[model samples]
Target: MTLLQDPANKNRYKVNLVPAANGLNVRTQIPFYSPWRVFFFADNAADLAETMLLYNLNEPCKIENTEWIKPVNYVGIWWEMHLGISTWAMTERHGATTENMKAYIDFAANHGIDAVLAEGWNKGWENWGEKDAFSFTEAYPDFKLKELAEYADEKGVMIIGHHETGGDIELYERQLDSAFALYQSLGIHHVKTGYAGPTPDGEHKHGQFMVNHYNLVMQKAAEYEISLDVHEPVMFSGLCRTYPNLMTGEGVRGMEWNAWSEGNMPSHTCIIPFTRGMAGPIDYTPGIFDIDLSAHKEDREKWNSEDRGNTAVHATLANQLALMVVLYSPMQMAADLIENYEGHEAFSFIENMPATWDESIYLDAEIGEYIVVARRSGTTWYVAAITNEEKRDIAFIANFLNEGKTYIARMLYDSPESHYENNPEDYQILETEAQQLDGFNLKLAPGGGAIIVFEPD
Candidate 1:
């Protein structure tokens, strides 16, 4: 029997490594995110997970009849805040304006992005820290909701509504129907909802009460045909299977942390797939072109001050690119400013990659160390490999590829000089030809990754 099935040692293994220190900020414990993540080789793993999600997963399952929502590859108006350049309100610090949003819409028109997310478009952001501070239906004067939707619709782009409740669940529920109505009237079907703080004092995030709260929101939201992309959310527990409208949620340490905090360790990404990912799709919001923060160093320091650690991505450009495939999100974001990406060669991979996969295989995985995933969409296959703080060598055969068909392998990889802390931006791009029988070797740098796209030759 394998370690997971061998009923020999329960108390010996603590099930999780992240201590209470990691979760004090979120007002929850990390032990709950572990426990049932050790098994994956079995043929009925998903069925086993479904049984667990209903019982020990600690999340309430309120299944309803709803059609599956298609995945979207999107962009947003969020980089300015992460860079510490602007705030969300309408003051001089405000970053999202009509002209700027239109520029984003124009950019989305040409690129493959499906939606443009506008946070702080509503009026209540000034009181974002105050409980019950936001009005769900009201828009800031500068952000013309009517005209903005028209502009996006004309450009063949969709607008993703934003609702930052700031932990006021009561107030959010009060306005839910009307707010969703407003979005529906404007042709907006997807929205990002956030609860940045803990539920009223003395309450925790994953408690049964709060779990039901999330389910109520998803159930109510489905009536208006709106899909929810949640931030500052409870850990995933496979709720998407029952409510397909609950598309993706940001429940882990993500790219934004790299801007303000000590930043997520490279191993954090490798560790999460085995832990929290047992739940569902994560809106980790990957894809940042400026791995080297030189262009925005001043802004980052101004905004973060002493809290900012390295203020740089711990991975090469190719590593960031590989995350698009490795981090599975039906709703993925090209999370960088448009201008920075105009001339970059790696942007094409993000552009061409499909939002959903037909089949996926975990070529290899080791908790907190490294993982490799190969996904197929239509006739092409995409492979991504990533490692933690340590660099490692990897070699795999293409036996998964179809036999007798030659394929062009477009690869984006880390350079020899690439090191997460030393030189995060170093990378090289190449195209090659290979067959099902051929094997390839990859050297993942410290905090680095590799991506390969195979198209029939």
Candidate 2:
């Protein structure tokens, strides 16, 4: 009459005795409760993070014959709808017309963004309640698709297609091949698929069937050499190891929530890297210069009430910029309207950061409180740190740098006059020389963040 128990309190491994219906006591066991965690006794925070990635990841899963697998730093037409600046339909406020798209293409090309995403380029966006409301191949009258495609090709920018099917998987599956063929012919190798609203497959979005459905879409996308970024997706659990082209996902409370609904708490990003982010990379769409939410007053009043009532993203402008590094999305989006980014020096950070990284180090982290990360793209290293609603001050030892090497640290962070609730936009820039033996200190405002880049001199 013995029951198996955990041998030690600190170890995560556990087991229990199981009795069969026939009263047989078997030596069956349970796995570790903390399956995703691996503790390491390393030299520093950077060492711990690098080791963690190595512990969990398999080989890079690039598909065969997929030539020119490009990185996905993108600019897109998503934030306008949330901000009430534009609608997807063919109306006065519509933002995805040919003229407007061409302007965005120019902006992206000038800023080093690799792809452009237009949400309502196709017809049937206004009729979601009806069956087959998404037509991926047919364009609206004002959205000159072929011309825009040619322009993007000439500019050396890829055009990312959008397909929001209102959860009508049947119709989406039926149109899948033709839609993919259209994109392939036009030289587009990526698509952002959305499954908003309920699933018609009589299953919850996370149900086995829906997960299988999402997998089927990725498998098919690979056939056409098209990578996928799915919204309203199943939680990522090493799916990238199986499908290398499965880039970013929108499964958690994202930046747009601040526009229309009660925005995500400041702790959201700090928490996700261990929760939702542990499953896969997230397309959180982080760039927004207008924290006040007063830009579209009439729309805010008419739709969500002028009270605004804690609808802000609850972070400083620097925090938004820092998210590009802390949130590890290969398919990253500078998701704000192009005009909002004008003349902003912080925009330069977004422009300079690359979509892929050769190595990453989770420098310091506390779940739902704060996090610090460092990553190397090429010869340069970028560091980003973010805090929760509470104010925090952090200290970093530059021992992560190579020994005896001198580097310049370029920082963008909240100023002394800034607070996420009181003065969200105030930021200061600093440039200084540092070495691996030196130390750095950071002061974070309530719901604030910081970005530091180290380049060898």
lDDT of candidate 2 over 149-196, digit per residue (tens) = 999999988999998988898889999999988988888888999988
TM-score of every candidate relative to the true structure: 0.86, 0.87
Candidate 1 lDDT tens digits, 1-457: 0122235755344333221323432344666663345333444322222233433444543545455356888887897678776778778777778888998898888877788998888887777678778899988888888999999999999898999888888898899999999998898889999998668665566654466678888887888888999998877666676677888999887888876767777898887766667667778887887876677666542565645445666677777888888888888988888887776888889888898898888877777888888899998999999899999997888888999999999998889998988788888889999899889899999989999999999
> Which pairs of residues clash in candidate 1, taking residues 3 or more apart in a chain or in different chains?
none
Name the regions of candidate 1 deviating beyond 4 angstroms. Answer: 1-68, 299-301, 304-306
Q: Looking at model 2, how many pairs of residues clash?
A: 1
Alpha carbon deviation, residue 414, candidate 1 (Å): 0.7
State, as a TM-score between 0 and 1, how close model 1 is to the true structure.
Answer: 0.86
lDDT of 1 at 65: 47
RMSD (Cα, Å) of model 2: 6.3
